[model samples]
Target: MGRMGRIIISVIVILGLLALGLKGCSTTLRKAVFAKAMPGSYFAEYSRIHPSLYQVSGQVYAFEKEFARSMILRTPDGIAVFDTFDTAHMISLKQTLEQEWPQESVRWIVLSHNHLDHIRGSDVYPKAEVIGHKDINQLVADWPNVNSDIASVTREISDDQTLTFGDVTVEALYMPFSHSSTIYGFHIPSDNVVFAPDMMFVDAVPPFGFPDFYYPGYIRALDRLIAVNAEHYIPSHMDRGTRADLIAFRDMTVEFQGVVEDEYLKIDPEDFIQGIGMGDAIKSAYDRLHPKYGHLHGFDAMFVPKFGRHFGGTYLGY
Candidate 1:
């Protein structure tokens, strides 16, 4: 390896050892790799944000609290919420909801998936009926806090279903095994808006390859999302989205998978010494991909780690 590459590896190893476990090592390495890879800022413009409560269409609105975002719609019945984003953001989120549509009551909340971060904070709307996929029926029943009184899933959806409340009709698209089996996308026909988790990042790579990610499942779910043709898409993590944004993310995923597979196939078993070969392979993939996707947010810091994750998963029988 060249001096620059060796220096990069050394910095990552030192940071990894000092600050984090294998996961921390990945996080630490992203910044270092991005710094060395370019002269300009490695972080993408889209990665930066000014969190706020904003409206997308007439009644469809979104509130951003730190990294958590919630999509709210003002309907005839009351106000409908997609996901809470986080329990920690309850105070701020509730305030935003009240301030934006004070007259409207929080009638119901539909969970995009069962991930704790997105599903928490339903207690803020005590009267609101909590809705989730049938997959999480047992999960909701078991959770002490939810089933008791403050919050509980009053209704459950098993497959693709439509809900007409107020003036809008919401279509729930069941997505299994993309990010998780519990994921469901809610589509509003009136506003041409869709809300869900694991759809796609706005203009950046995902922080990592999650343990539950199934390549075939992601592809299938993504294709289904495209067919829905909602002009606006709200991923719980980042609410600002367009059809182009999702398409770009899907393209990136397809390309990333292809490139990683080709690189993995070329890795010589003999080069496993000192972990040199694996590192080089990751670097090679980075070099090839950066020119195309480097402009996206977190590409430098997250690209190699993601590549490592997908490649590593291959080893574990992905």
Candidate 2:
């Protein structure tokens, strides 16, 4: 071979190898692996907040004042609220709903769970028929200093419980563990929607928490909800949504479940060694997912200790 030609060929081969190595390290590859790890099948549709609703300080973590107060289900009889803002913020949300749907009253108030964010504002809507998981009442009852306004009409809900109010039919599906003992989602069949609180944090990964409870159950509940085929899955906190979001959530749940199961299934010696690194897998997943969903922590905030305890991780390692 000619000297210059051989040199040129060598340069081409080197460049080709470099290109192939870079391809494996590309952000696109990372994203693809992340997607496989999460297995999301749908995209959440994002839009500007509806004019009728606006944010209040207590509605979200103090940092996010832009989060809307509640999801208003407007019907001819009245507006059915998915959840009310914290007690301090409910008066304004009630007033705003009244101003927009002047002829209607707040007919129903569905509590997705017993979380402060879900039930704090129960007092403001005096006439609404309150519905929630059966266990939520116990959460309120256990609180020695429970707000006086929430004491009434705090009905216990069960799985398959159907609530018919005017044109709306709300079906409460019990979603226990993970976040709370009595976590639940309200399905609005007429609208083909489900009001899911905390189950799908959308863009945020949850921090650790107490009860040191069942996360696999959370995945099961999500799977059950998907089996119901609701087109719109709205969260009690964010208060807006679509069916595709739930589908994506389903895919993500499946992926996470697979990771956990796969990690747990390793043979004894490998299991002990790899178990130590599972935390890294969890963190890597979170780090990759965080950029897209970091805003999640911006809302349903949790301390690292609670998260660590909840996930059984020493810290954020897994």
CA RMSD of each candidate after superposition: 6.2, 13.0
Whole-model lDDT per candidate: 0.72, 0.54
TM-score of each: 0.79, 0.61
Model 2 residue 284 CA deviation (Å) reads 7.0
> Model 1 off-target regions past 4 Å?
1-10, 13-51, 140-150, 268-277
TM-score of 2: 0.61
Error of 2 at 170 (Å): 2.0
Please list the residue runs of candidate 2 whose C-alpha ends up more than 4 Å from where it truly belongs after superposition: 1-69, 145-149, 209-213, 238-241, 250-318
Can you write out model 2's per-residue Cα lDDT over 1-318, one digit (the tens) per residue? 346744754465455445546754566655544343231211122223343463221111110112433555655676667666476557767666567557768777777667665577787867778877777776777776754556344566666677766666667777655557767666666656656666655543333343434656766777777777765555543334455666665564455445444443442546555566555544554554444433443211332333244345322222
Clashes of each: 1, 12
Question: 1-318 in candidate 1: lDDT tens per residue?
Answer: 346855775676566545444554476566665455442333244345555778877678877665667888888888877787556566677777678668878888877777666777777888888888876656656676644322556788877888766887788888776777788877787888877576767777776555568776887888888888888877666436787888888899889888887788787767654465676678788888977987776665566568977887666655
